[model samples]
Target: MTPSAVDLSALGQRSSAIVDQAGNLARYGMDDVAGAGVRSGESVTLQAPRTVTFPDGGSITYGALDHLGRPTGVTVHITPDMIGAGTHANASILPPGWSGNGILHNEARSHLLGRQLGGSGDLTENLETLQQAPANSPVMSGFEGQIRRVVEGGQAVDYLPTSIYLGDELVPRGITLDAQGTGGFDWYVRC
Candidate 1:
């Protein structure tokens, strides 16, 4: 059966459950930290919003911010369909102040799943912290409209034609295309 034939409602539900559980765990973990009092320069990882899977198998993972912290933005996982007839496999949009070597990817089902770096900061440091952050730490808050991106080293890739709801507005500042392709990107609330 084609991917479309598969009933994703159940999968979506399961995905939601997993996301919710992660968020709850992060909250609980944060509660412990809060009990002891949060420290400056101390970063906590919180559960992001649910991963919204598209009918075509592409998915977008939301990021979170604590009430007293800042988050860069959410991560976008694109599928082959989302990539369209693109020739290049290695592509990404890095955030501002990104000092990383390159984009990260994991191969699955003979396809390379690129992990777009979401949020802006020291790429090396942020990536390390993101990997090290507890699975139960809360995400930073108040980062709904401040996302940006810059293309890094790689062959020019086709932009994904899609629109997403970040809080209450379509992304890319009135455009519905995925402009975060193979480079540095950032996001913040627009006045």
Candidate 2:
């Protein structure tokens, strides 16, 4: 079942510091859980906001690692030039709890900012350990397709993808995506 607005509000508040501005934690809808199927997990966002600008002028802002050294998430500004046949060449620098043979073990060294969206596999803080099902799910791919379409059409998209963890769990329970494009499209998906 979907969580209530009040419940999400309370949950976000009680979790780590999510408010981008000071003294604004009570503004519910601004930071309300984005999707209908959002479950009971801590919501993460761009904690450190460190931007890595590509040669093509596209950029991705990576969040800081949590206390447990887990990635908080990423916000990416994607352009047509940023999308390509992405690489998986660097699997050596993945985070803790990643099985060496991730696909064989039904786990993934997943990217918070997906490689298809110009994210790097080399950054440990940009990676997370995830189950293979959700990592490759149709729902997840659909959201990614929307972002891709906007960028392919020569529009820029500001996309935020957050990894949601339950307590001290090394693997995330789910991911949350918030995307807005210059093409006048906005989407929020939970997968």
Candidate 3:
């Protein structure tokens, strides 16, 4: 099936808001996935499908919801026009402070360390504590590698989709375009 063009600008704007909230929660050792008002694990069939527009006249249409009936994910079909010049690859479209690396460290990893060390008094102390802390600490083990993969972005981690998946059925995420204009990267999401 032919993929449709999605406006990166519009998706960036909308996703930025969602990521901002998610990031804040992550920083505090929390996740919107289980917050009080969040929908936990509802069936995907109940949610309505919607079209997400981009600033450059691109758009994606899909329906997604988490367990709690809140929008959780989307599968966007990439088209030639969606990868136009000036479009960002993924979370890169978010503001500078929202880089995947930053979020991994400041939010996910740091929070884990804080719990392990009982809260260090300063950044230096925190680093020192982490340095002195056991390498096998449960919280610090797998996350660094996970963050590295996310920041690097390649075949294992791409923003564009070969297909679209949403809801409970595991639809493809992001956009997919013909091979001609899709030279460098596959796809990207805003942090």
Candidate 4:
């Protein structure tokens, strides 16, 4: 009953060639519950069991974009070895609804899984348009720092950062940060 790349397409917009290309890159998690049985606001875990590891050791999975080209959710396992060291140089890829002046004004091309956390800066599937206030504020940075600290200490953490879009809006209303570390760390940061 896990959600495939195509099954996830039904949740928002139709699948496109771009979505297919992104799906091919990351490993997707299957839905434990039937899609039809899912109710609004109910928690849905769309990943396979934790024992199912990625081939690259620390890999990320980006759900296909909705028909509107908005990001759905992004999942990644953060490990110390996978953290990137240099400054992030995002490739020339832009997320949906990107504007040089910002879609909502002051919107930033945010990374759901940051480059420091092993997310690809150039990957379109890993980017989203997030409000600059929260995206650059201490709240977001603090949460990411917590995850980085935990992982750097040699603990493995499973992180899922989801962009919460309201209705058909292209920009996310907020982002829900979920992380669980093997070192007895579990937290959710909604910003």
RMSD of each: 17.3, 9.5, 17.2, 11.4
Give candidate 2 regions above 4 Å deviation.
Answer: 1-49, 55-57
Q: Which one wins on lDDT?
A: 2
Query: Candidate 4 — which residues are off by over 4 angstroms?
Result: 1-56, 85-91, 102-104
Minimum summed lDDT over a 10-residue window in model 2 is located at 1-10
Model 3 clash tally? 26
Q: For candidate 4, write residues 1-191 as lDDT tens digits.
A: 12112233233321211111112212222242213222355433343322223454765666656567666667677776666631352647667766766545866777767767766566555678765564534445557887898988878897777666656677766665667788887654445
- Which stretches of candidate 1 lie above 4 Å from their native place? 1-42, 79-191
Better of 1 and 3 by TM-score: 3
Looking at model 4, report the run of 10 residues with the lowest lDDT sum. Answer: 14-23
Each model's lDDT comes to 0.25, 0.62, 0.26, 0.57
TM-score for all models, in order of appearance: 0.22, 0.70, 0.23, 0.66
- Candidate numbers, best lDDT first, in rank order: 2, 4, 3, 1
- Model 1 vs. true fold: TM: 0.22
lDDT of 2 by residue, 47-125 (tens): 4546678776788777877777787777777977678644553667767567678769776777777767777787777
